[model samples]
Target: MDTVYSVVGLGKLGASMAAAIASRGFRVIGVDINRRAVEAVNAGQAPVQETGLEELIAANQKRLRATLDHHEAVLNSDVTFVVVPTPSDERGAFSLQYAAWAFRKIGYALKEKKGYHLVVLTSTVLPGSTRYGLLPILEKESGKRCGVDFGLCYSPEFIALGSVIRDFLNPDFTLIGEYDEKSGSLLESTYARILENNAPCYRMSFENAELAKIAVNTFVTMKITFANMLADLCERIPGGNIDAVTQALGADQRIGPKYLKGSLGYGGPCFPRDNIALSFFARAVDTAAELAETTDRINRALPAKIVEQLKPFFHKGATVAVLGLAYKPFSHVVEESQGIYLAKTLADIGFRVVGYDPLAAEPARIELRDQAVVLDSLEECLNQAEVVIIATPDPVFRRLTLADLQDRNVETVVDCWRILEKELKGHSIRYITIGQNINDEESQARLIKLWGNTDANSDT
Candidate 1:
């Protein structure tokens, strides 16, 4: 028999997962507290804005539906995936408040259901959260034995906001934290059917899977931080180029580079918080995650450091244009965005700031209210500034021509991602690529002083 899937919490990740599963010919029912989200799904629309989500949901409307009732979703589907938000608390640990409520509802629903069902947690939480914190709620509320009566698994998806659907369908590997062999095998089989790729499944105990999820994200953040440090070093070296260095580094079999781009600091909902959370968890366990802690601190300090570097360029009330308010490119999610941080920091330092994003203008406006003027178009932002800073590697920013940046008032172009290096290098404006040496003469003198002159042969 085909597995009927139910997804709780119709947020970006949950809704996309539901739509993706239904796209694979599975009957998927989604449950959410938001009436609008439920209505949107039923009306053949995406509840949240994600790349290819609305189209996917609309195409798979026949197989996908949503409801507000947890009982209905739990009773109907063979497997239920809890994808509710596990927001971080004061201590940097993910709060289980939302997940606990969702679990309680599912527990009550399970009491009335006849056959065996599997409850899968797809939320990011600290280790022992699933087996110790959440499982007891299910057992107590439902009044049923876990392994004998039903099953549970902690299987968080490795996905980003913009490409959730594609990532879901084509994950590098599936991490399943199962209660037992029966539960793990059931989910593994379901994933084999649903996933587009022949992805390997790593099944283990619940706690191990929970740790692995955060560990993956935290480790990636460390790699990103390491690259950002290299960018800092490159700026001081003669003939330094981050791309050249990273390209060579990536060729090494040991360091197959994905996040080795020595540009701006990494920011988004996941990368920043995951590192801090790992540090918090380490301290809680009477150990230390000093590397994770340092990574987070360095990333957080990046905006201020960049502002200090550009301080000399700022005059009394000089207008600075910040392009790309979203963390990376595409989509309109600005949570923990480094672009927003730059704008805010510049504004606080008495520079007149104007910010622009292709999609995240409104959210950036809300975030930068009165701190910086969030403009609708990149052209408008460029027109109002003496200095332009490309904070994200958005394709729109890359498409900017020499004509667009040729304003007499504009004196500098700080290309954090080096997108406009070739086009703007010899332009009238003082072009500064973050990871490249700006003072060539000074750098050369320092190198010659350190290593002695290569031009003159030394007597042996």
Candidate 2:
């Protein structure tokens, strides 16, 4: 049998990594503390939904299997990828317990094994954490000098939730922060086919790689904050559309368009936590990131602003339809998502909220069971809703027409992504949206009267 590479967690990222490595003609054994998670992968069932995960799992089933025993997985493999979870604490510090727990166990497993193996830390950690926390433990437990008896490196995984399989097989770039070139070469060889495509390879020291992940997220968060600021300004102007302004701005060569559209501030398992963690890391060095701190405040306040707008629309005991509940477009993940926070706030304020998402319905239901009613069909949820709030811009939701919403009891539509703007116009239905003009005749008149017409055209 050929030597195998082991993935020490069977979550979405870990499972996808195992399947991807196995598909490349290598043996892969997945390990997870959750027996059910392990069993699902071994039986060709993916624990999480992704674009092409099932096919990948089936194609590599023979070469891939799962187990709960870390020792067995470690002893049987030549290379190990530690892709465990590293969530944030209540005070926003990066909690290392989960990553530390897995690393400590891996260290014990390495103690009993005899071979020159490579272990790559694929989880996000604060700068200098791997060198300070993980390296010393592994060296202590194994009673062997690192880089001599074994090799270690940090090659962080950067996969989007719904498109993980594709991201893994064809990454935009690969960041390898190795202790030495020889160790990096071994890790790079494992991804030789991937590297052959000429994707950018970033070679750096361990701390820089850690900060790079945080820096990327911080930059994206800043972009989102800037977009949201424009959205707020656009709402105040009479005829200004923030989306249109930003679209034009994006056309400029200097500002090439991507994360420029304003919507609910970023939230998922990654961005918010990473942003806060980066800020905390900066504070430790007696240097504070004022911009990152501002971005986080802006993001947190966005959901509240959404709730405030909906409050005036709600009559006593009114029902509201919340569309697309996931944090982002297609993923089922709701961690730190604005949609979930909005649902909770709406429900607490006495509005009955019904949420619908293409893939996130079930997960959202479990996550928000006490906060709102998660529905399977959009049509049913909108039946008696006084307001329809499209929280997520799921491509499927964009296909909805005014006719479909006409049959519902919806008196107003809140378009978070500026979606269905033309369709809502044709129906002449009262609609309110972030980053766009209000369509309700009465609301428009009131806004004009209160604010007075200043420059409606602010696209210069």
Candidate 3:
């Protein structure tokens, strides 16, 4: 009498979604091509490394199970959610090869099953992909008419890697792209039961939903770029503070402060590629996505810009330690990580670069092999460094005291997030905060030069 769920592809997002659904007292069947992933799920363990994922899976073992057989999953479950990776191709578009394969298998399973089944695509793809690219495969394989014998929906999740479980269960809102009214209503009802927060659902055509997903990510990147631009301007102006400026800007109802932090450029699995894909889509449609293009260019140039800023402090053959190889704090994912990019960029420029992360050391090591030495411990990295750059504001890095830098004989410390300003300032080391004016005298001189000084007593 209840809707049973089957999630295809047991990656980070898929496994977490499956576990979260089952935790809410629903039966879930997970399908994956990887034998190890399936085995891990069946053994009441997490297939991928994510925060709180293993515990969630172990607690809901009775309701959640995984299998290699797609047929078994589709036949048993009422709805199947395809969460496969739609990796970006060389052309800057998401290649739906994996999604197509998974859809074909599900379509074959639907052919044998003699009941109404719903198929939902949770993978990120370009607009016109779900309906034009993937839907035909389903109709052909299943030999069934859509909206009659079966249903299809495009429903991608808005989640980050480290906090997938929490974000999935309590999204601000859900986007549902439906083939027909029947399929949309069914999914809306299912989400109503699963979501912890009474999140609003936005239902529309498949193409609109696909465009909306990428549009949301690109818009966030634009905001992040705007904040970074502000940080650059703050560094140039005397007594300019990014926090003060953004705080007031955020006070306005139109520009609420989310992702408005003037920190490092965004880099993860999603933001970078999504922006590029939107640009590519724009070009295809004979429209100019100059803003998206410029945002990406700025974000990509951030590492080089930081390197240029630190070049003055770098001495010949000096060891420079980079803290936080992951893109963000408390994450192991190094995909397009700005920290890793900084380390590699410095290494290429002949600075003896050493990198460290709390959890992403191993992956960063593989990424920066022979370019920079990826150290295991934070103390080890700090010990052999003449200059240290705090790339991400990790909690461990925040707890750094005077003892850490004073003992290391470090000459310069660049705090990208400005987290160590209070503790590190006025110390022996030259502390530089990215968004704050380092030299007031120099900035004041430039300001006076730009506009002829008019003293208070001498009015023009």
Ranking by TM-score: 3, 1, 2
Number of the candidate with higher TM-score, 1 or 3:
3
Off by over 4 Å in 2: 1-3, 194-196, 310-316, 439-460
lDDT of 1 by residue, 1-460 (tens): 7789999999999999999999999999999999999999999998888999999999999999999999999999999999999998999999999999999999999998899999999999999999999999999999998998899999999998899999999999999999999999999998999999999999999989999999999888888888889988888898888888899998998887899999889888889999888998899889999999999999999999989987876677889999999988987989999999999999897889999999998899888889999988877888898999999999999998777778547888999999988888987888988889888788888887887856566586
TM-scores, one per candidate: 0.97, 0.91, 0.98
Model 3: lDDT equals: 0.94
Using alpha carbons, what is the TM-score of model 1? 0.97
Tens digit of per-residue lDDT, candidate 3, span 261-281: 897899999999998899999
Candidate 3 clashing pairs, residues 3+ apart or interchain: none
**How high is the lDDT of residue 251 in model 3?**
93
What C-alpha lDDT do the candidate models reach, one value each?
Answer: 0.92, 0.83, 0.94
Q: What C-alpha RMSD separates each model from the true structure?
A: 1.9, 4.0, 1.6
Write down the worst ten-residue block by lDDT for model 2: 190-199
Clash pairs, candidate 1, are none
Candidate 1 weakest ten by summed lDDT: 451-460
lDDT of 2 by residue, 1-460 (tens): 5668999887888888888888878889898999888888888988667777788998888999999998899899998899888878876777778777787788888888897888999988889888898898888878878888888989987778888877877777888889888778888877765332556778889898988878888898898889888988777666768878898988999876778998789988888877788788888889998888989988998888878865776677788888878898878788888888888888988888888888788889888987898887877888867888888888987998887877767788888987888788646667777887554465567787887767677885
